[model samples]
Target: MRQGLGTQLRHLIDLLDGAVSAAYEEAGIDYRPRYTPVMRALEGGEPRTVSQIAEAAGITQPAATQTVTLMMKQGLLEASPGVRDARQKIVRLSAQGEALLPQLRLCWQATRAAADSLDRDMPYPLSDALAEAIAALQTQSFGARIRAARATTKSKKETS
Candidate 1:
């Protein structure tokens, strides 16, 4: 059977992330591609809540929270309670994360160039397809589609 869309999407991400991770490993940098967004969000020493980071990084809240937690464990990030909202925690890049920026920036540039090269060779660029898919999903989410399919299945079963 053909692979599902989610499986294929994950495979693509794994392939890209693995290549980037391997490059970082060769350069003696302990970094993951997932760290890039969080690092970019915390650039310039700005303190932001997890939600703010999610918005800045264009990722979901849970993803930002998990990445922030992992980064903290790796000593790449620090968190403190917000001044205005004690319940809210603000996250900032650690000194170590800042120190790694120059190397990371170089890798980021190389990665972008690599991605562009990959896109150029493809008839339908992955980046463009992903962006368009996201825009379409924003209009009609996958969750809605899944629920609709489920309802159809249930209705058919009920009539039988």
Candidate 2:
């Protein structure tokens, strides 16, 4: 049987992330591609809450929170209470993270160039395809389509 779309998508993501991770390792950077968004968000040296970081990073709040926690443990981020709201925690890059900004910037530029090259070689660019797919899904969700298919099958079986 052909590989399912979800599985194929996940495999593609893994392949891309793995390649980037290998590049970081080869360059002597102790960073994961997953942390790139969070690092970029904090590169401006502004303290932001988890929600703000999540929005800026285009990731979920839970993912951002988890990343922040991991970065804190790795000495790449510092978390403190928000001045306006004591209960709210704000996060910013630590000195160690700031020190790696130059290297990260180079990596970011390289990654962007690589992606542009890949897009040029493809029939349809990956970013455009993904955006269109997301728009279609928003118009009619996968779950709804599956339910409709099930209903049609059930009706046909009953008629037969």
Candidate 3:
């Protein structure tokens, strides 16, 4: 049997992320591809709350929290309590993180160029396909689609 869609998507992501991670390693940078979203979110040098980080990074709060914690452990970021909401954590890049920007910026530019080349070679632009998929999912979630499929399968089985 052919591999499922989820598996295929995961394999694609692993291939891309692995290559990006290897490039960072080749550059002697101790950074992960997963860190890119968070780093970009904080690149403006504005201290933002975890919720703000999540929104800016286009990730969930829990994901943002997890990434922030990892970055902190790497000394790439620092966090302090929010001024108005003492419970909310405000995060910013540490000096160590700032130092990495020059190199990261170069890597990012190269990566973008590479992606553009890839999109040009493909039948459809990968970035456009991803955007359309995300928009469709927002309109009707994957779970809803799965449920509808299941209902159709169940009804067919009943007749059979």
Cα-based lDDT at residue 125, candidate 3: 100
Candidate 1, residues 75-147, lDDT tens digits: the string is: 9998999999889988999999999999999999999999999999999998999999999999999999899
Order of the predicted models by lDDT, top scorer first: 3, 1, 2
lDDT comparing candidate 2 with the true structure: 0.92
Give candidate 3 regions above 4 Å deviation: none
Q: Judged by lDDT, which candidate is best?
A: 3
lDDT of 3 by residue, 26-94 (tens): 999999998999999999999998899999999999999999999999999999988888899999999
Tell me each candidate's TM-score: 0.92, 0.88, 0.95
* Poorly placed runs, candidate 2 (over 4 Å): 138-141, 144-160
**lDDT (C-alpha) at residue 46 in model 3:** 97
Report the C-alpha displacement of residue 21, candidate 2, in angstroms: 0.2
Candidates ranked by TM-score, best first? 3, 1, 2
Superposed by TM-score, candidate 2 places the C-alpha of residue 46 at a distance from the truth, in angstroms, of 1.5
Off by over 4 Å in 1: 152-160
Q: Is candidate 2 or candidate 3 better by TM-score?
A: 3
